[model samples]
Target: MKQIQRFFLVSLTALLLTVFTGTWPTIFKAVARSSNPVYVAQSLNDLAPILQQLPTSVRDRLTTFISGDELYRQGDAEGAAAFYRQVKPDFEVSDTQILEPIYEAEALSPESLADWQQAQLALDDDDEAGAIEALQSLVDREPAFIPAPVQLAELLMEEDEEDEAIAVLEEAATLHPYSTEIIMAQVETLADEKEYLEASIAAREFALLNLDHPQAPEFQALADEYFEKFSKRRRRRSIFGAIGNLAAGILTGDRVPWESWNSAVETAELVELMLASESEFGASLAAEYREQLPLVEDPDVVDYVTQLGLEVAQLMGRDFDYEFYVVQDSVMNAFALPGGKIFVNSGLILGANSQAELAGVLAHEAAHSVLSHGIQSFFRDDMLSQFADEVPLGEFATGLLSLQYSRNQERQADILGTRVLATAGYAADGLRNFMATLVAMTESAPPEYLSSHPNSESRVAYLEEMIQRNGYNRYALEGVDKHLAIQAKLS
Candidate 1:
């Protein structure tokens, strides 16, 4: 009877696939709502043909559900819960009957529950040490129990044992990487202790690792805030140190060259190396492209873009001699070279609805230069050694053109670019609104700019939040009339 029932279910599933390839959601719903869900789950292997006909996203969700069902039947409820959590937010199975196991697994067992209650009682009685002791023992016994460690960390923090509290949350995060609660706790603690860099890194890593999570943008924004704080603090220290060095030099009758500063010296060396000869990497490659690519010669058009770019570039906190040029291409594209050479396609100018939008694009490219993303990319892939060895300019240019910025790098640019845009008195949402335009354009065909710089709704949301959180004045400047005049010159 069992064999016959399994065969019948598989045959029915295959028939449904044959008849309803276009109605995949209906078919999956029917299967999930089957009266004998366990039997349907068991017969999933025999429905391989049907699964193959489904779209990849749907197929993946179904596969995850099937794996979770199998684990649940095998008595590993905890393991099943882990799998269910991934698909639970967006994919529902029989009104989340399939996801209920996660809630069940999250509950404490009788022994752990009693211990938790005791800790709460101690806290209520103002016995902080007792609560801490109880929570520590409970967490040690059941490391997977998330709340125990959280409570213990809170107690430790109240007792002014910040290091131990951070350690406790860190261990908990290692054990439960999926727990946003634990990670956020850790980030807040680090930020409270003024460990801005560490907090920024932690938040950024979480967002990068879990891009699909609903809270990813929030984490990314937090990372931006902390990183900005860190940068400001470092800048303050540098200024004071520079003043001290100047005074000492005057007293000792010895002057240090400004170019001898580590960052300036390193940047100067890189710039010199890149522009050393026609056969060298950066400048040679840029020159080769200039010969092939049609460029705008109208002084007005070029000057307009160069002036706007320089306006935003000054606010980027980098003192490089920034330069901008316009390419006679109908593709919405712009790119920055290793130093400060930026090329903007004519189409990008016509694509902008306002001057703020154009400034936003230029600022983003300038941020790439200011952040030294191109140079870092070369060093990261050890291409600098090749450049030193005098690799053929064509081959080196190929590598440079094909460089894809990591998601983290892209987010950093967006954050910094937005900051400079607002500081330059342009609308703070200029970059974000431009990204939304790209997102809309993607529905038809993706823009060339997006090919290199991926844009998404989450990225837009984060920029919006960053603007609002910092109280940036988005209504300050639109410059639509000025932008139209520039567009007219190109036309």
Candidate 2:
């Protein structure tokens, strides 16, 4: 008996060694066919020592299968399905019984199942509002249940609550980042609303996240088609905007505010004002403003901000000589002038938790300069007319400070800034996270920054969606240590 047992132990050890060395077919089949499959599945962790011996691809598939099996046993059929689908190509078990969970319907609790049924009943009765409310409640309680939010968003869309519907889908996407169904629903909704840019982004994201999916090529093609549509639409809007601005300027008798301002101070003169000479109109204005405001003269702090700003500005496709200055104010605020002159408040630098956050602000301000938003605002508002025949430097500076961007312009800057941030290799979510910080900071009263740059929950949601859709590297360099050092210097 002892000799027989020793032989059996030796055989088992050899079998495990073979399995670890890429000879897993036989053992896998045996495990699948075992009468006590649950026991075998639960004991998968015991093979952890040998798992590392397998190739990374094979190891990952095996681990994914194990995770799916665990979820299946825990009655999370939908969750298990997602995992199983990912590894289905690799794990082809011959035993039907072993793979039963993959094909099983999702198991919901009694309360959830009843609620789902009630929602269906409401839909059948033509009570759309009731159905939507029920579905909303279901999703609120069981966010992981993927179907509820999708159906709820559809209902909300039918109700003409397009923004709210998009918000719902965005929240669902956040909960199930890997759910192809959820992403598809989001894309379709956005397309229905003619939000071609966002739709194209969503479709491209699906392709990126599910590279091996058979439909990836189809989605990629769809993304291109939508982007083409978006481009055409943008061109049309630009022409219309130009015509509208012309008519407005003619009617208001301020036909060339921006052109006049530009002629007053050439771009080169503005650069000189920011860099070397203090005799130019813009430079002298900047000097006067410095006298009124507390300016940070710390060379290290100023150089750090300037270099970081340059890094982001370089990728903005603009040839402007971008310059950054630090202010000693304690208000969380930053702004950009007509040229590439960006001012950063020390309070903003201190408030930022990481270098990425500060970089986000710089990128946003640079985008404003690149997009010529300030000039456009000045033109549209006929800001120059508010001044005398010769606009005083102080009044001009004050006008620049008081420039308020429209919601559309702010969104444009946000989108461009996020792209620049990601391209510059900072965490892509830097701006989104900064917005979240601002939201938290606004519990008492809105900050000075929020006054100029609007803050809303939806803005943060859309930013997150953009980041996820574009597959931007949010885990890239955050520069926390460097940020802390700078903060300490300011302190």
Candidate 3:
């Protein structure tokens, strides 16, 4: 049992490393990637989600350490060790390859670092005012010091001075428009204050700056929430006017076909509401889940998966900017969020007999998004149309992704996805082979893939019949060399 667990753990680690590093053999290469301001900026943005999972104090100090190089260069290992000891004494700066470029992109001058240290000391001594003063002075002297304003804003917010905190954030945002910290702080504060208009504007700007960021979808959700709220406010006023008209006998004519009229109006309203926020809301929920999952960082695997998804998407007859990612979970599962984002577990990859099997799974999930089964399965019309219009997106996101669809929806996705494989020139037997594999695994714990996608003799029979009826090329493409290479690396 211990050996089994250890094997799984090592496999998971290998998959996790695949994301940030290139191939497995190159993982220990001593060279850092070429660094420029643009690369550093993007790298820091990518690191935001990981850093945010840590305790706030530790995250702050770690950010400072990454931005300043004096500690290691000046042989202050003792001092660095002492500083890290406060958080996790066992922590070492061994990931210097990752940190080198960030250090090279340091914009914080030595004086600013000194002020930051002083502010930290003041805060440690319980001199709140002194810390604020020092941080404020640092911000003033070095407007480009991204952390100073953030620290100052945090201090202000702690004292219940939210307005001042927002002011500091706004100034910081102007100075560093691409800084995720500043934009998030300002947007969240404005949002909490019900300043939805301003918040929406800031969130939009943030989205444009960080389109590929995990936080980008969250900002989209925020903007949609604000828009929904603002729209509903106007809707309520219009409702009142309609009520007045009804009271005045202005709309007294009775509808002969009440069902037809109601259905049309309801459908229109649902369409409008969906147009208002569903895609962004769904994408945001997926983004949040992504932060919780350890993602594979290998560009090669990511590109291969994404390229396949895009091809399947093209075959779906829709133009979706599909995003594919690998999750470092042992569960053999693949699921799609509301948007085009799809996640496949590493276990699924290693378990697949061929790339055809993997492509079949991806095509199936992509079909769910293309067919809007996720949206239809999760939300009821009236539930989504409350005058408040405050959809509990976060509450439903993970649940919705895990929710099983109706038999009809499942069948449609299966047929369509199988057809997509054929259309994309992959073996039509991919889905059939994969489902057979799932059925064979029923003796042990069932794979999570079978939870949402129930496998049965009938389903496989239908796939076979469909393949015959359509005369799909069952032997076109079975797998690729890259898939075998990836499996070897993971092993």
Kindly report the root-mean-square deviation of model 1 from the true structure over all alpha carbons: 20.0
| Model 1 misplacement above 4 A | 1-285, 384-390
With candidate 3 superimposed using the best TM-score fit, by how many Å does residue 267's alpha carbon deviate from the native? 19
* Deviation (Å) of 149 in candidate 2: 27
* Candidate 3 residue pairs that clash: 18-298, 19-296, 19-297, 19-298, 20-297
Residue lDDT tens for model 3, 1-491? 77555544544543443332211211101111112111112233534543443344434544443322234234554554343333222112221211111111146678877788899899999998999999998878777656677779888888888889878877666545556777788787777766565566566556643557888888777766775664565456444543443443424543334533443344344434444554564566667777778998876667767887777767764355677888877788888876677888877877664456678889888877766566555442333344232234444454465457766557657766887788776667777767766765566577777887775546766676667655776645544333443543343
Q: Name the better of 1 and 3 by TM-score.
A: 1
In model 1, where is the ten-residue run with the lowest total lDDT?
91-100
Cα lDDT tens digits, model 1, 85-185, are 55433211221101111122238677777777889899999999989988887787667776677778888888999999988987776545456887799
Backbone clashes under 3 angstroms, per model:
0, 0, 5
Ranking by TM-score: 1, 2, 3
* Candidate 3 lDDT score relative to the true structure: 0.60
TM per candidate: 0.47, 0.46, 0.45
Residues 181-273 of candidate 2 have per-residue lDDT tens digits of: 787898889889987866765666556445568888877787778766765665555445445555565568775766544433443233233
